[model samples]
Target: MMKAADLAAIRAIITRAKRWDLFFSLLGILSLMVGVLTFTVLFVDMAIQGVPRLSVDFFTSFPSRRAEHAGILSAWVGTVLVMLLTALAAVPLGVAAGVYLEEYAPKNWITDIIEINISNLAGIPSIVYGLLALGLFVYYFGFGQSILSAGLTLALLILPVIIVATRESIRAIPQSIHEGSYACGATTWQTVSDHILPYSSAGILTGVIIGMARAIGETAPIITIGALTFIAFLPTAPFAGDPPAGLFDWIFAPFTVMPIQMFNWTSRPEAAFTVNAAAAGFVLVFMTLAMNGLAIYVRYRLRKNIKW
Candidate 1:
């Protein structure tokens, strides 16, 4: 129905549109390259300055008043302990809430309200979470300035992310899978546990790892919870000694994490401490990268194994 001139005009328009799309795509790739390059340069610089300082002693000894003798033993140990607590607190609750919302909750105004609140919570500033922890956990609940307080604060911060990730993963499972399970005389719990959870594990794990990576690097919330910045001693052992400090003693102990330790070192006037900060930064970056890599590997393996 179109004449030759109109056909040519349409072709020209499409050509221009494709040209613009290609131009924008190239621009976006360039931007990504720039970011990667910048991070590479910074990482290289830090490695040069800090790698020489790293030794077995750096991991074995505790923080010292003298920069030459300072180490991150307490800092790293507290970091691990806090992260363990965060995982224990956040994962089960987040997963359960997500499962309930996606599978059991009725489609109603209450569900909509809950969903909206979660979406808003995800966008809230980390510092605000810190303040809330300070008020509720530290003061109101009598958690004190302890690892438990810090861990719980981070748990709350990452809960929304985990819930959303879980819900999305569950949603991705084909409805036919559910129907087939029901057709086989499977209960709702059995259907979810057998079909939905196995298929969604990869996505959920990826989200959890990402959330934890973010939590490890967080300084504001822990600081607000009154985490000590100059700890030189590890928390009381959970299960060692003639009479153990009790399994929960460490939770109530004062602690310092790698991020806060790095921050404290960076704030000092000495060049040596600055170098220490760089080394700690390198460790933290390495940890975060390892977590992300694990998440990627898990997703790849799961996707590969399950064709659907």
Candidate 2:
């Protein structure tokens, strides 16, 4: 029933819209390729400059003033221990706070303010956390420049991220799931434990991985709290000390992480130290990738078991 002129106008509009769509589509592809290509080039350059320096001894030997002989033994070990402690300190608190906020806390202006503050915290610069940790963990609490202090600092840094991730993940569960659990005469805690927690665990782990990846690479906070740049020794091994050191004694040991080691090497005058820095950077990236890969695999497995 349309007039020929009206039909022609409609066709013209469709053509114009399609042209704009094509333009945006091409723009998006260009942006994605730019990022991918940039990363590929940088990674390849690092490998070309660093791969030859990697060897079995490079992993085993302690750092030395002689750059060619230096290794990351202490750096990597401290990174792992600090990360382990970070996880221990952050996970439970983040998860519990998230659950309380989402599942139990009353909806009110007070809760809104708290939620807004938490979200804002996620965007606060990492250096501010470092300053706070320096004062509270190092000077105030007398934790000193130790593994425990570093661990707790990084834990604080990532807590907001974990809490937000947890809330979002729990929010994603179907409303029907909660209603069904309630219909079965389940209590709030029971419903949450058996239904909510299991379903959202993958998402929670994803956040944890992201937070940890950020924590592992952070140098500002660690350095602010007096992490040594030239740690040639490892934390004292428990039960191996002359008097058999207490299990928690290592928590108070001085520490260093990979980024700090790389920073130290890169700042040196020698070319060999530059190569060492590149190699350490390569290994740090690999470790981060491996951690993410493992987390992705675990998330996939978790999702596979999910009924919906």
Candidate 3:
């Protein structure tokens, strides 16, 4: 019913709007490209500097006073051990707490307070966690400078992250799933175990991977717990037959992780150690990327398989 002139004006306005939308879209793409380019440049630089240092001996030798002789054997082993301990300590507790909060906790002021505090904890600085670990795990609890203490400290740091992820994943499921489980005479625990947990497993795992990835790169909390920067010897193996430090002695032994070692190298006056630092940094980045890739794969598989 519009006049020709009015219709033409309307078309012109829509055309202008579309042009602006296209402009913004291209701007966003350009911004993303900038970030990608920066990362690629840095990665290529590190590869150029560090790839020559990636011999088998580099992975098998211990730290030394000489830059050429120093290696990351102790550092990488300690990193893996600390990560195992952190996972054992954090994952179950985080997942359980998340489940309780999302599925069981009554909606009340206390619950609201708890939820708010959890979210706040996630945003708190990592150094504050280090300070707390220094006070409680290092001094009060007297775990000393052992890997056990470091693991527990890192566990506390990542708990909120895992809980938040679990809750968010569980929340994504339709309420009808819960209703149907209940209609079929499933109890609350049964419903969660059989219906919610299974469906949310992928999300929970992604969160755990992300959390552990963060934990592996943490330096402050481990350092605050009095971890050595120059550890040159491996911890007693969990199951060394000859010396028999027992199955759990390694957990109680002093240790150093890759991040701490890399930090030490980067601080050195020598130029060669800088290359060592770059190599260690490359390893850390590769590990983090692998974990992230696993998370992405998990999410994709779950999304593809699960209808709802």
Candidate 4:
């Protein structure tokens, strides 16, 4: 039989472990609290200073000057155009490539080379993409610094991210789902489209949304690709003008987007421009927040609708 003293010692050892676990838990909680508090303070400060300057004119009219500067309308429109066209250029192709690689591609040296290149492309700095666009669109192909040029650059810049995201989303579907479909004599395409795609749709959308948020904040690549700080006209259909020249008109034609405009406003010598910058910053923050909120909503719905 064990002695009472021995029993007491074992209990003491277990008690000591419990204390250490509680201490670490307390430490983790404190760290989280500090992070939350810091974020709150910074966001509150920005909002306090920024809310007053955010007016309808700030949204509707073109930037005029100091107190009287009218709006961010043109910049907002350009940013939308850039993002939309970029999405058109990147999404379907990226998703299709991801689907093919994740689903159908044989693992071979050629495929391995492509995979390696895709991963490297993801890590390449955005400015490098700008240079690629500059060389291809401006100097070599001569697309000019137009909206299409910026869109094409951003499309390339975001492709790896979207492809990686799409692959992950597809991979998350259960293999059993595919096997079951196959047992039912469903073709591979039908099984993938009907069963796998819907289940992973939310995750894929989330990844795209997150990627777009990052793209919206980009400046260096767009600048390098010859996105101008100011443009008199809104971007319409790309390649509508007389072409076949250097196509410099294609890629190098001057364009502007919100982030570029904000950077320009902030760098000006005038205080009014600085104010416009802050206001623009606030708008950017809002847009980013909305995108995140959408991702969260989509994720929630996905979880809710999915059955065991």
- Per-candidate RMSD, Å: 3.0, 2.7, 2.4, 4.0
Candidate 4: minimum summed lDDT over ten consecutive residues — where?
Answer: 244-253
Q: Is candidate 1 or candidate 3 better by TM-score?
A: 3
How high is the lDDT of residue 29 in model 1?
99
Q: Residue 105 in candidate 2 has what lDDT? A: 90
lDDT of 4 by residue, 128-228 (tens): 99999999977787677777788888899889988998899788787888899999999978887888778777888988898788888899998997777
Q: What tens-digit string does per-residue lDDT give for candidate 1 at 1-308?
A: 88999999999999999999999999999999999999999899889988988999988788888987999999999999999999999999999889999888999999999999999999999999999999999999999999999999999999998999899889888899999999999998999899888888888998899889989999998888788899978888878767867988889999999999999999999999999998998988999989988988987886788766
RMSD of 3: 2.4
The best candidate in terms of TM-score: 3
Per-residue lDDT of candidate 3, residues 187-245 (tens digit): 99999999999999999999999999999999987887789999888887766757677
lDDT of 4: 0.81
Which regions in candidate 4 have their CA more than 4 angstroms from the true location? 1-23, 65-67, 236-253
Off by over 4 Å in 1: 1-26, 239-243
User: Between 1 and 2, whose lDDT is larger?
Assistant: 2
